[model samples]
Target chain A: MTETHWAYAERMDAAGLRDLMLAYGQDVWNLAFILTRSRDLADDVSQDVFLKAYRTIGTFRGGSSIRTWLLAIARNTSLNAKRTAFMRRTILMGRVADSRSSPSAEQEALARRVSDEIWMQVLAIPYKLRETLILQAKYEMSIREIAELLGISEGTVKSRLARARRRMMDAREEVEQDA
Target chain B: MPDREPEWYRRLRGNPLQEPGFTEEQMDRIERLAGERSGASRRRTESRNVRRSSGMEREGGERSEMGRSRNETNGPAANETESATGDRVGESHGYGESRRGKWSGGMEPVAGSGDKVRTGAGDGRTGRRPRRIRLRAAAAIALASVLLALGVWRFGSGGADPAAPGPSATQTVPGGGTATTPVQTPTPQSRLGEPIAVLQLKGMLAEQLPFSAEDVTGFEIYAARSTQALTVPKERTYVLLQNLYNLDLKAAGMTGVGPDHYLGSSESATLRIQTKTKSYTLDYDLATNTYGAFGGTVFRFYADDQVWLLMQGLLNAGSIWAEYDRLSEQSRIEAETRSNADEPVSKAYSPERLQVAGSDYNGWEKQFLPLSSGIRINDSYMGTSSLIQQLGNDEPEVLRVGNAIVFATDANKTSDGVGVGLTRDEVIRKLGEPNVKTNTRWDYRIGDYLKFHLLFEDDKVRFMTLTMPF
Candidate 1:
């Protein structure tokens, strides 16, 4: 196996980046699919993500692995894209709600339980916490890799995930109590 | 809570994550991207492979087996990996991907924060925005509980833990298993004599010198045997002394101290602290063709390679000029070869004299041992060391001889310690000197600095060296 960026995240020309992305395309796409739950979102975000990585790789100081850097970019871009879409929909809905005076009960219920609610919640946490959690759940990365990828103390990562778990537990307990 | 941490860690021992969707295509893609990002660096890997394959073709293509042989030559023995200095030991398996399967306690570090992120509830999206993010945070916590339960269940079922880190993460340096090291202990001969004493005396000199040498210290003379094959007759020793003393009087850097009645000249050259110093003297005795040649008494008042590096360190590092370059570590054998190059002199003859030994491959080969110690080294850059041994020891004193020059070392183990690089001129001037001297090169060993009569033709100080580490 060959490692390219031991020194730092050096910049790549477009064609070269294309080859690298193609090599890691499935991994990146799969990651995007899980994050966005949309094939179109995964594609658009992936292409955009690689270009962004290409543009800024020069600034990468190499404190972390290249995969971590790329994944971090993909994660952030997808989240922002999701946010922008939600905003656009919000604007559209406000207009529709104002025109109709009130949304129907079924429509309100459907709006509350969007098709990707579970995924949306999973993506909602802070980056540090979410990354560790996802690697454990999806990529099945060990604590060592998670620590290496993010440049965090392994102890810190563990506690952060532990906190995340506790937070989820409390959240569930509250919801159940309410129910 | 801290103690409880270990229990959570214990779970990692039982439940290992299945391999992710890493495939050959993925690895290839990564390799290509690495290439595009690093043109030559990536190219070097493939080229090296190609070079290896092509190298095999030249030898009838028994390449795979030959490759291992060549690779072994690069990192000769497993023992070579024990470097005295511990800096370069790092990860193994130079793969390009970042995310990997869980190693320690089955927790993969999150890849660095990327472009994907969640938005605040009030960031313009209408219905998708929950009134409070606290709800989303709660959902995340819920996900964690479920995963934990799953991990625990897996653990209970005797599945391998995804978190336990490999030995690489947990091992210590002594057993870290790197492939090349220079952690050799010197022999008792090194501990017994002037080298050890000089090492101790170096501390005192270090207090005097203003600077220090980088990396090299604790030099031990591996051997100090005498050789007798090259000894000139006693009468010739007197004649040689006369010629050398005359040469010193005419040397450009010399300044006479007393009247010409003493019939000798003194050479003086300024020295940079921790750098090479340039000066000494010579005297002639008319009765015999004997000239007592004495000059170039270098004294580095510093510790270690400060003086030596000062003299020879700037000779184009990474250039072919270097005695040793720091690039190959893939194997053990190559490191051994490189180590030999770094040393100026290696062998010490068992007896003081020999008629013949070693081949005359590059430079002069001499029978060495007994009265004079010799070192044969390739005088030019990129050249191999041939021989350097004393030819004779009529007096049985261990002296250094090389090229066509010869000199004796005068080190002292005082209360301050074993002092190396003390001036012979100062010693002779105070002691009223030798009844005879050799007309050999005006040589000096001042600390780590070693200078010989490099300019027999230039009656001036053309052979001055100022790079001793003191």
Candidate 2:
């Protein structure tokens, strides 16, 4: 109903969708980039988020700001994509190593792969533990803030954090021993 | 691990958790998405509140109809939502695979929500079964993979000029947030101004004969019957005619209206009755008596607590309807007399004549008819008035069948008006217009007559007929 500007509605269009994809696309790709460790997978996830958001925007009912609603969609889409990728890989290529086949010399790809391997170990932990570790490791989000975001008891946050760290440490030891 | 936390855990507490996978572009998409969703939610909430506050007026007899009109306007907005979902699915169709991820694990629940009206109605048709929804889901997965590879091409490429809006008003959302473009007007009629003319059907109600929804032919038969009955007695005619209109609605099972006397069953039922009237509006309540009066005076039998009060409760809609017929007959007579008195024709064209035109053109009124050969040519057209009985007047130029009149010329083409004398042949060759006739009985444009009737034989002027002047 903004007579002067329908900027938000326009953004829902293809060009607007593209303008948006281009403008803040890197954040989405980076999120996808980190989760999949494959640039292509990251790009795919970024586009999916927009596609879903564009489709469902009509039902948004605008209770909160559009930015907030979109972020929620982003979070949901990312988590779902990550889980599906995990299942498909597990199903098709039984517990494949996170290590790249080529192990190319480029530092960035290496950095991404090594981080992804660590994250894969992180994902192996239980939901409670994984949740705490992701907030701490990936987001650098403080425990208090993470507690607020997840709407959990801070005590639960504290306990989960303790368990996640132990898991990470155990995972590091196993890798080291194997090496 | 330590008591509260291991030292490494403590270090982690302050550490900025690396956001595992979101790239800058991903964040932007999320931001814009949130903006749009919020905007839609706000609009819906505002309208809901508006409807709530308007409830009292919405139910009011007159206001309820207006509310229905407004609801019809909201249909386009629903279509907009459908298309948006369609485009989204089409985009997903390109993603093919590699969509598996942690969050994807539970999405079976979210996708279960029935949002797939897109594929069913996205192409502008509606109604797809749940099967279609599942089918779309499969297509989306494949399409998603395709779009992913194309995504690099899409995002890696530079942004050029924005895509121009589609050729439709809703190249985006169905009706809202769209712009209009001009279309060319191709004809002189288009330039003539407001070519879209309507005879104001609602207002035309009281102004027409048998002003009801009954087809013209059936009603004409009824009107002829009623006109025959009109001479019976004024009071009885009133009782019969009104019953006709009332029975028409009653048979249709319509009720509920502005009041007890004012009623309609549903909007559709109301429209059926209303189509006969000049206008369809919330103001219909005032029209019950007002519209009928304009057509002519009423001959309705008096309604009193004695007869009306008793039957008013019993389906004495019969009485009201009978009264409509009586009043309608009275209205018809008054209009005929007034019409006949004005120019010259004695009455509205007989229902038998009207039966021929096939069009519902009701108001072809009487005017000063220029008669010759008794031929009525394009009575609806301008500048000529004449009527022909049988193409060639053979029988004694008098119509002896009913209350009819005949006037003919005495001289054969006198020089009085037509510059020279002539036989029927010469008359047709020169003054082919109705005013010139063969017999002297044809007066030149009867100074103050209503029309001239020309009687012809073998397509040649045989005699002249004229409407006697007062």
Candidate 3:
């Protein structure tokens, strides 16, 4: 979308905002879930992303598509939530296991779908690679867009995507061999 | 040639991954939260406005108070009151706007009484006013004497009185007297040209020094993994010092006088701030959000958020200039390599060329020929029409944007067995709710990548585009 199109977010009224939430809510929630790997955290982060957007919409400046902008906010909010003392403690206590063993209903459904095992593997990879892979493969973000959103160099994004795919492929091979 | 992603990756675009169900209830909650935030923001703005208007009233009162004191005291007391008012006004201007507002708010009642006293003095009846004025003058003199004594006591004790009126204190004079007791503003000690340890460490950090290249003899960085420190160039040292100088460091406390004072086993990095006479080492522990300085004694200090990040970035990089140069070079090479490759389409819709070993699609390609060739919902009208035309179909209504190709009437059924003329319930039984839905239109994912848009009329599928994957 053109930069001018994003200005709609700045002037968006309640109805416009509702339409926005309807259109991109899933994308925002999905990105948040991928980054945090916790449904509860994703819900909180998604709410926070919209709240922040509402408060700072005047500063949007039409720099990116509203979806990309919301996703970027979701990414930052998720990372920040993960960095909190509470989340860190949870992570340290090993309560936040891989997606297959995660207790969330969505995760359970994910684990049951043999075709969806690729997602479980995506989640198993390191955070940086997993995030880069999801943004590229799932969200269809360009390398340049991912780099800007993550505040990293394009070279780093490319390298992480490559590494993430290789790791997923290896994990798939292992699963097949076991079967 | 660049590496191709495996075919199984296409599952990501398929609706295999289930997002948590977002309901109207959740949207209502979001709206409610936003409303509460808006209300709070409005209240804050109104509070500021009220404070501002009250501040203006106080300023008017202060002026009247000054005039009354000048008329009533007409002596050293008057001069002292004028000086005190002047100092308060100076403080209001010197400090920030919020503090200025605070000063005005605090002085309002005192200034209001002064206005009343001035009005009393302005009365035409001069007989009783003389005695009242004399009584007020005597009280002002007595109050001034007490203040002078207190100042002397404080000075002799070599410490500030804990109960002394500070900048934020609201002082009220007894009776109707507008004269203010003299207040002695404390002078902060200078730490110029002193040894880092001997000087007031906290004050020195807070002070802005007139730094020159000659002041810093050496600047060294000790990386977390490195045992020895690397001496930074003078130019870079200046930049680093500038950042350090700008830091607002709050004195946390004095560390214990042993190796145990060091909080962590490893530091993020250490900086040696070298001057001509002495070298002060600052050890930063990012994990603990604390830094220790060793300048004859260990002192812990905390930097504000921005300064802390600045310090972390500089130390983490070990060499900021080198890191920047390396990243720039790497970016340039990556940009060149990317330019050589074909522009990547959305990976969701892009045809997968590389198959993963031992993975099989059971005649998936034959079942969905048009979709396999990338024709899907939301594809450009021109592109979809051209593709359909190329397939040798001369359906006249195909060029119309909203015209639906009825699968029940047409030659093809989707791999998922979904066809046009299917009831809304039947379609839902097959595909579930659309990812995006409106009253008239519903969009469902064909796989992970392609979408199947169904146009509805009278609660039934009138037109549908794209075939779902098996």
Q: Best-fitting candidate, measured by TM-score?
A: 3
- Could you tell me which 10 consecutive residues in candidate 2 chain B have the lowest summed lDDT? B221-230
Docking verdict class for candidate 1: incorrect
DockQ scores of all models, one per candidate? 0.01, 0.03, 0.06
Query: Each prediction's interface RMSD?
Result: 26.6, 29.9, 25.7
List where candidate 3 sits over 4 angstroms from the true fold. Answer: A1-5, A85-115, B1-3, B15-21, B42-470
Instruction: List the candidates ranked by lDDT, beginning with the highest.
Output: 3, 2, 1
Maximum-DockQ candidate: 3
> Residue-wise lDDT of candidate 1 within B22-74, one digit each (tens)?
34453443333333333433433443354344331111111111112111222
Better of 1 and 2 by lDDT: 2
| Per-candidate TM-score, chain A | 0.58, 0.51, 0.82
Sequence-dependent TM-score of model 3? 0.34
Candidate 2 segments whose C-alpha is farther than 4 A from its true place: A1-27, A30-41, A53-71, A82-112, A115-128, A142-155, A173-179, B1-470
Those runs of model 1 whose alpha carbons end farther than 4 Å from true positions after fitting are: A5-15, A33-40, A92-129, A140-156, A166-179, B1-470
Quote the chain B TM-score of every prediction: 0.16, 0.16, 0.22
Clashing pairs in 3: B13-B448, B14-B447, B14-B448
Question: Please, what are the lDDT tens digits per residue for candidate 3 over residues B74-139?
Answer: 221122122112212211111011111112212221122122222111121111211110111111
